[model samples]
Target: MPTAISASVAPQTGAEPRSPGPVSHPAQGKTTEAGGGNPSGIYSAILSRNFPIIGVKEKTFEQLHKKCLEKKVLYLDPEFPPDETSLFYSQKFPIQFVWKRPPEICENPRFIIGGANRTDICQGDLGDCWFLAAIACLTLNERLLFRVIPHDQSFTENYAGIFHFQFWRYGDWVDVVIDDCLPTYNNQLVFTKSNHRNEFWSALLEKAYAKLHGSYEALKGGNTTEAMEDFTGGVTEFFEIKDAPRDMYKIMRKAIERGSLMGCSIDTIVPVQYETRMACGLVRGHAYSVTGLEEALFKGEKVKLVRLRNPWGQVEWNGSWSDGWKDWSFVDKDERARLQHQVTEDGEFWMSYEDFIFHFTKLEICNLTADALESDKLQTWTVSVNEGRWVRGCSAGGCRNFPDTFWTNPQYRLKLLEEDDDPDDSEVICSFLVALMQKNRRKDRKLGANLFTIGFAIYEVPKEMHGNKQHLQKDFFLYNASKARSKTYINMREVSQRFRLPPSEYVIVPSTYEPHQEGEFILRVFSEKRNLSEEAENTISVDRPVPQPGNTNWESEEQQQFRNIFKQIAGDEMEICADELKNVLNTLVKKDQDLKMQGFTLESCRSMIALMDTDGSGRLNLQEFHHLWKKIKAWQKIFKCYDTNHSGTINSYEMRNAVNDAGFHLNSQLYDIITMRYADKHMNIDFDSFICCFVRLEGMFRAFHAFDKDGDGVIKLNVLEWLQLTMYA
Candidate 1:
């Protein structure tokens, strides 16, 4: 059994700072100058819709297949180490960290530890990145990591330890693996020099390209447009930033705190102090986080701390918002320089939180969880078979019983039966019963009832040998609460041959079977007074063939041909016979002189009736007759096959021969009885019975088929009367 973890954390309410009111900034009119062409229109539309897209290039199926053959590994940066200890070591190594937008943080961390207890690969795709990251984070947890991977030899013998990364490619998620390390400075694997020595980085890039667009060439010179496609499922809509706000870090932090991934901008008319420098120009960029804002300040004075991350990670505001712009000339040069601390190019910046909310699009969150439980509060009953099998016709004492009700604790009852045995053959017929009871305080009185019932039966069988010698053996019967009124009988005869069975402890343990319906029935097993539902009667027939194979009586060629012809006439119908066709084909065959005349000839009648016999018995059952006559118009071959003997006219001899060929071997008395029973005033038996009788191999089958007058295939009322008057009478 596996456990599901909740994805989101509950909101914290104690001592959290209140949200700030909206404020207007002075630098609101500046246009973005970083990118040559302005995409403000597209950006505005995207902001209004609030749909995030992962811009990645599409690749042909053929190319993707080719790339799958190449093996690659993604080198992960040390900053995101396997565990807390590794994290400390990686950071101490002075590795440049590959940072992303702050709003992307989630409560459920991914990542687990690897050891004898746990070792397996996990995947992350679509909006489940948070869950995947959580899994990755969990790798640091002790034995908790091994829970996901089953500990078995199946995993050790094969390359089963691989985890896959799926991103929407073309139309569905394409699998990709972590291949190589990102760029690194010093011993770190992030923000290294462009000329850094690393074939692994190139390999990773190649693998990424292969996963995205199928070829390294396609990935070679593509700009951010192509990269976005490869990353996200759709294209990116760039936007221009006019006069952006200062304090972007605060804005980024605030967005993250609010669980939002949006950014903002401001067009200011006057110079505003941002960080330690004054900014007063058109600025354009994406917002990442929001920190804080000064509220209820003087009407003329206002400031906010906002943080932003550039997807590219290198660009910054160079105008009035730049670290050392002249708008802050009122401050000393050295002091201004101090305020202009270097903002890492890694897609992070500071701006007004308000502006950040207005400019960037927020990605949607999608997480799901499901839960299931087993109950102990159920009601049940035991079903006992005394003299015969569950089906009607079988040897005596081959009884099978089960609980008549559904049981919540069905497994417990089954266990008890599996353990019990008996010595005396007569007393071996008894076993144990168990019931699981649970308290339910529901309004309904019955709702608080017991849950399940299980029982076990002990029985014996006799074995006879040469010289009239006989021995008695003992066995057990088991029943469960899950399946009502069902008990499995184990014969002592079978047990003796399989294992030594003589004497053992015998205990009538109590059991319970849960009821499927609401009702009451007689209680047979447990002595406890409880309302037990009656078990539904299920008629199960078991077909037992003799152990010997290839013992069926052989049929002659003529018989085979007759059987084939009969089947062809029946086609797809069920219970086809003269009794079935009486209302339809009977009237038609009677009214149409041509049909009667044709039928008068044995060959023609056989041709028409042969198609009605489906089972190759040379006889047409009611079902087969009904189906054949219904579609007689569609049967073009019927007339040809039934018209045997090639004579122009059919006589009594031909009719008798056709019947004989079809496998009917009745004596004159039986034939006359059947004929008179199914014949009309014209002295001709109806086509339904005519065809039905041909395939009937035994006298009993013929009698049974004749007794069913309504042509439903089953004998109904008056069956005995009809048989007495038509045959023995």
Candidate 2:
């Protein structure tokens, strides 16, 4: 009965989203699913050229470790250098820090002492308690803990200065490598630390995380859900404890039983910052993990109790339910042992469920299912992840507000193969959640870039458009209504919504609410049942190439003009070099004031010359020149028809038809590549670009036919011939 909220919802009224964290897989009997099979799935990416790494080469642990072992030297990470820059970005330095290894802090250093537990993590001077809480929760599930911290690693073996940790970044798991140099002040760990002085896993893990997000200062403060997702890759749902349903305790019991990661915290409202440290021994803004739930026998009655652990070691809740409170004297030893009640200030304590809701303002539960709407569903979700980009004018077709380019956004096909199985069997629908996340805004701190307003719209695919591999175009979107969409568009890192609809094929268009904002994005769709995913299907079949010479005919006067230009540019033998061809086309293109442009580039003319340079003279002759002139005239007419406003550049929407008009057949795939290549960031195709694209295509097609001896694609090209083809193309 809790008001379930996705990560997208903005903070308001009773509750707001904290950062999400990863959940443990249900495979270890920690969390059980209705079906034993691993139902979660990931969609392969297309057009996933990620943010450039710039100059630094990527490093891997296996390779770096082997190299260090061979050389018998400590591995120093060149990327995240140990310097003050790695400690602070813009925040004022709170202390002069010294960097040290675990051995320097304690003689008998340990990667992990005995076993990992909530007691292992303790907050340092840095305000990253949220991360500490997640680490505490991570210890409860070994399956998830081993993933974030590879268990194979140790201090005794492979004792290199290098270490690595895995974090779920966007839709993929990335291994962040770092050096073992821990920042210290007065010889103590400066950020997140371990309770055992000699223990170093948590400290090194924090360094890897900081390196992943740019610097340690960047990890100053965040929500538990964020760390939970990074650690467990789980779907997180948040609840305002104040607005929680009557069965909130039941929900928690079920979630934890099913391997869901749990974390909570007292409200961190800025206005009440001074009151954060309460008299009852709870920090107002501190984050804590829900490690266990039990019913304590008090006054011969069962009172719901939740076990909480503070990220700061040695802090205990001191209310009536506090350790050694006189009320515990009444409970028998067996019942007390069953509840695991310990009398110590080990940062772990029990608070009555009533007192829990009164003090803890919020709770976050991350699952391995599409339980965004109904968080307690006992199901395994099938997830599909795809990476995409929204280049201005190209793929950044804004929301439906800009109908002209809306279809230009990346399209994904969602095929609901079957409906969810229901005992009642009254309704037939597929339940899925679509989450669209724009990447890298958090790292652009220097540029001051904020999250863009992004969302996705789902439209039922028409019967005819079901199986084609073409992208849906402007016309299709203009005529069809979106079957479902994000609940609302908001400027958050991620915006997601849950939907239950009739089982059918649908097209999901993910885009920024405003057009022309350039950025990379990842799209994720989680379904309770199998959902087949692919790039959006085409709105229609490809139109055949336009007939040669098109429908336009040249008049006697036009032919005379063409001959006059060719003869002047060439000679009696009718030979003209690329420079001459450039001049001739520039002159011809300027003839019509309505079709006026800056004129074709010399490079473009060279391409046109090469297209018909059969003898490889790198020049055009009378016959070839005549053939090219006729084609140019016909193509110019097509451009004029599509450039309705005579803007000299046609909108991307008109590109396909214009290409077809110019006698080049194009399917949706090629058309998509063309737009990404030739169209400017604004998505406009000028005459020069239009001509150049086709010229290259024609040249490549011709080259393929000539080299493909038997008409099959297989070819044996010598180095020189391959160079010639590549250079010319």
Candidate 3:
């Protein structure tokens, strides 16, 4: 027979609220081209280490560069070499496409012409305007700009043909290094380049980014938030301009004041409208960074204004309040001078807030810290970010809709101790934002690995159960509905939601919307105050302590009673078959009201007999029954321990630990099979099912090892061998 296997809470206080959708969080698909193992032989399932980016150990640009200089050779990245594969994953390589160092394209090259500035970036031949938009905002803050683009190293000083950049990946900042080779056509940069001909920092930065994402073609189009997060390790808020809040201008002010990076765009309604030049001078579907914001007196009224820069480095806005617009006449001359209003056509321009909202379709605010949303300057957030995985059979329990398997998903505990800081709001709720970001989906685009439909749900733990430090099981979810969840599960790189949940103990369950879909993810929760959180687990490892019998332990004359029962159960032959065992077990089950069982099924007895029937007799002899009785007793205790409420079903996820506790190693594949075979509609197993599963698994492993003579985990079973194996198991 075949086997099968199976799965972020947010905080809130009672009432649920909804934010306007679509218009608020509209995302663009192509804005610009720019962006097992084994059963452990126990401890052998995985290499317990954080391997460097893309399986290549990070090479130090300094060490490699110094070595290159000393050896009188140019530095060339061995990992991401200047090759066609690195330049384009799907497109055919252009014949004249050549890779050249900065010096090859110019007589004298400089890392930065003067200093890293927004103007340093000019859209080249790639469709990664979204990435360029983010880069423009990155240049506005020296601290953040330098963090991504290091200040040291120039083209002529000890230049080793190498440069390094830092990007936030998962939960850590990864230092990505690359050689100075730039993809070019006829000695000219092919992608993002600087306005200055001899300057190459922007070009080099683009190359490094392309390397990070696998190829330049993978950077074709994406949301601005994606690049903003990669560059700053910040969380972003999406606001659909047409549906924006009345106080959106104020929110932008606070976000900028808190050192957040911002970008906005006019999205294309149709494919043909992409990059369409509007009469107002703003290009539809083009990425733009919000570089400045201010309020000025116009016609005796305070007019909100926003300044934005098109990454194209040209096409200044041509509307009221734009560069050299007639609207400037409405404001006092002294006020214009104080605000330092300028009329330069450098792709940067200002417009009234009303016009800004009407012109731009979407706004993105990437906050360096959660405090960017706080009105109180002293208030801050307690942020907890966890790296987790949804491994098939072991942890990839689908969504709650699949009640039988959802509990198998990864579980996390989040405790909010304080409420949101709001004097006017009456609800005693904790305001927090939870973002679940899938890892490596973008980098895997070349391999056709798309984003998994990922989302999280939050369930408030009952106060009575909070004292038990164990992973909530399927039974828990079967009884308690999720209080809050993401707007909806979507196949996006990240899904996030802000919630004002009641302060309490909650379990955050993150999963791919489907069973057995495997992937890695980052789950982050930001609370108004310190949050207590960790991965929730009820798994009892073989190395960890298990509940012991008080006073008398097993094997202490208790064996005598067990042996007597086995003898009585086995007839004159001093043995018992599956029928006999079922009769005995059913009799006992009916006699005990506390057991809460409908009696053991025939399948359970058969599995029990198979486990200990060493001789091919299809039954358990006295000695075999003795061994089976001991296991039954021990397993009975384990089931009772998990089914604390004693309605007689244990959490489905506990099966792996239970098998391990019984001294049988379980790899994820085998676990998957067991769950498919035994786990019920509730994603849990009863006492009978548990015993049957463990016994059958034990018997199968034994028979498997017998046939697997070479022990390479492979076996060639003839008809006779197959009969011998399947007949009992």
lDDT (Cα, tens digit) per residue for candidate 2, span 310-417: 777666789877786778878878888887778877788888888888887768786754322123445778988877887665567788888877887788888988
Write model 3 residue lDDT over 1-729, tens digit each, in one string.
111111010001000011222321334211111110112222221122232443235545566777889999887787798888887776785476888988889989988866788877888878787788888877765555666676666888888887877787877777778888887887888888888899887888888888888888777766667887888777876677778899999998886677678888775544466677899898876678887788898888888888788887788788888878876877898988876678776677778889988887778787775422223563456789987877665688878778877887877888988887789989988888888999987788778776676788998999998855566666788888888887667565777778888889898898887777878899999776778877776332223237776744345665655556666878578878888888766765565565667778888898787778788788777677666766777777777777778888876677766776677654444566777778886567888888887777667767777777887877798898789678867
The TM-score values for the models, in the order shown, are: 0.24, 0.81, 0.72
Model 1 lDDT-worst window of ten: 365-374
| lDDT (Cα atoms) of all candidates against the true structure | 0.27, 0.71, 0.72
Error of 1 at 289 (Å): 8.8
Arranged by TM-score with the best first, the candidates are: 2, 3, 1
lDDT tens digits by residue: candidate 1, 1-729: 011111111111000011121221111100110111122332332223212122222533223323543433222322222222312211233334342211122222122112311012111111111122122222222222222221221211322112223343332334443323222223433321111222122223223333333322122111122222223222211222333246444443332332221223222222231111224322321112111222312223543433332222244544433344444445445543543334334333344434444543222110100100011222122322111111101001121232111111111111112322345554423232321111111111223322112223222221221122111111223321112222221110000000122222222222222112121111122211221221211121112224667634425663344334445545565333443333334334554333433333333334444445445555556455444543443221232244443322332212333344443443323433444444454333434444444323233454465676776767754776665434421
Top candidate by TM-score: 2
Q: Candidate 3: list runs displaced more than 4 Å.
A: 1-59, 93-95, 329-334, 337-343, 370-379, 425-427, 542-729
